[model samples]
Target: MAMTQTQRFGIFAALALVMAATRIHHSTLHHFDALPDASWGVFFLAGFWLRGAARWAFPLLMAEAVLIDYVVITHLGIDFWSHYCVSAGYWFLIPSYGALWLGGSWLAKHQVGLRLSTLALAVVALLVSESLCYLISNGSFYWISANVPAPRSFAAWFENLGDWYLPFLQTTALYVGLGAVLHVLAVQVARLAQHRGQTQH
Candidate 1:
């Protein structure tokens, strides 16, 4: 979809806000747990909604993610570089997240409106992209990061991948599912308004 500059900025701001709010800290609010990090979903939705802004939007979001992580880690009195999650492998997130963006972009290019076929395509795209992303991020950490002890083997890596894959997949799916629902609602409302205008005419 062709979005005006204003629309692009608005969507960018909203996605940035969601990422900031959810990425800052994992905590409970009024007996309810906070939402999981929305970084993965943000990139996917940004690709779908602001495909034209990929040149700048993607880098900005990546920077935001790093900044948030730095702040959170430093606040806890830990050195950023020495942190468990920060390593040479951490740089692999570029390709990891790029996978998601590409998936969403492909879906946006092929989608023909709200239909089961479109939904099916979206699910497939998300699964393939997420799997690739997990491999890049998880594999990099397992093989390159000092965080994982020596004696690394494919069997061990595969076991590690199995241990964390579902939670990450579920989190991404939850946010993407919400985004899909909102997209449907917005499209339906626009169609309804247009229909009413035509009927009045």
Candidate 2:
């Protein structure tokens, strides 16, 4: 039988919870080190599975991020609400994700795609998302903190962009690759489970 939306949602929700728990545990044990970009699997699945509702996908992902950020920030003595508000800018990453997925889908449908091409696209998409995130974060910090230096003009914005751009690119690419591998493994596991269930029946 085909899965119902509610069933699918429940499955995704459970997966998200598991991912979140694992992230917290690992972060704690290893001094807040990111285990993997498991959350990107959530984004990729949203694109491939629920492409039509991509906007909603971002909000949901951001909500999870907000929850996680809140815990981390509070533990570090930062104000929860302010951090949540700042983190809201992460929603911008969705458009970058959509662009990548859509481009890849289009290429695949045309049967003119290479595995490396899609992987490169994923990396570029992550970089774009990270750049956008840097802008969002810098702006938020400027807005919230009076002591923070203002990017008052185009040059300042450019400078700010340069400052975080490389780090963002590196980390985003790393996470995107990690996320892609996780997504592939997940698809394999799901297919295997389905096959086993069919055999049992």
Candidate 3:
């Protein structure tokens, strides 16, 4: 059965807020940390969790992200945008995130699940989706608007991909996989309780 809108929003809204808090406290440095930003995972889950009008959750979460950045830059006196928002490439996030949403949506459309085959298919879809998102996002920034040195080459861009893309995939997988596990556990617990109550009757 299709998921209800409230259930979808409840899951995503809580996750989005938590991730936004981490993003808020995040520094400009590139060092990895225990609470690496969860936007990538959050959006991936959004596509998985939301369908129909509930898909509106994407833009809502996007807005929350923007608001987080706004508070960080304006209220907190951080120049986050200046560092990355130097060109038209920044706006490509719409399509980048769209690809993420599409990835999860495609998984649901095909009835992918927790099993090995479905999980494998999901990984492939996620890889393709995130790869495309990375290309558009990093590619636009590097080739279009970024202040890359004159005479940029594929070698240099590949280095950037190394810095950003793999970490993104890893961070997203870590969190989303954990969430999937918890979800399965909760379903099992609920089912077990139901069985116990029925036996008692």
Candidate 4:
């Protein structure tokens, strides 16, 4: 069944909000929060669900993220993005996040797969999108950083790449994958209900 735009946004936005709540308590990479963030999933789902309006999806999602992080810091007492380093290269998130939406939109445009085949396509898209996001977000921030010491070695600064990147991938994959499963289940249930109603008539 075809989903209305409102419903599509509702499902993805709800998931992003709920899953991100877990991260808000201690969401930063340094915090070691085990719960996966729905951030990537939000953009991915936006690309898949937003249909033709993907141009505005990144900004919208970015706004939502900023608002959530502010609330997390002020209300929940978390330290994510606490320093001024964020402002130096933060706008790069526009492209980084847009990569995610672009990936998912590509999948939808290709019509990827309705069966389990979507898993492969989704993973490929996920990897490309997240990898770029990580590079842009981290690289730009680190290089432009006013907090880190001067004359830092690339090896020293980039040493934490694996530590941060791996978990980020894990979290993003966990939420996006689970969200996809839930979406499929929802469609199945709806079809079943419609089938039942038809039989009753």
Q: Pick the candidate with the highest TM-score.
A: 1
lDDT of 3 by residue, 85-149 (tens): 54667678778878877887787677545578877877887888888888888888788875666
Tens digits of per-residue lDDT for model 2, 40-152: 33444444434444455446755675577568767878776454334444444445444444533333233322367766665554445445545655555445454445546
TM-score to native of every candidate shown? 0.93, 0.54, 0.84, 0.80
Model with the higher TM-score, candidate 1 or 4: 1
Cα lDDT for residue 161, candidate 2? 69
**Where does candidate 4 stray beyond 4 Å?**
27-30, 74-85, 193-201
What range of 10 consecutive residues in model 4 has the weakest lDDT sum? 26-35
| Predicted model with the maximum lDDT | 1
lDDT of each: 0.85, 0.52, 0.73, 0.71
Choose 1 or 2, whichever is better by TM-score. Answer: 1
Q: Which regions in candidate 3 have their CA more than 4 angstroms from the true location? A: 27-30, 76-81, 193-201
Using lDDT as the measure, what is the rank order of every candidate, best first? 1, 3, 4, 2
Alpha-carbon runs more than 4 Å astray in model 1: 26-34
- Steric clash pairs (candidate 4): none
What is the alpha-carbon lDDT of model 2 when measured against the actual structure?
0.52
Per-candidate RMSD vs. true structure?
A: 3.1, 6.1, 2.6, 3.2
Off by over 4 Å in 2: 1-50, 53-56, 75-78, 81-114, 143-147, 150-153, 184-201
**Residue 127, model 2: Cα distance from true site in angstroms:** 3.5
In model 3, the Cα lDDT at residue 70 comes to 69
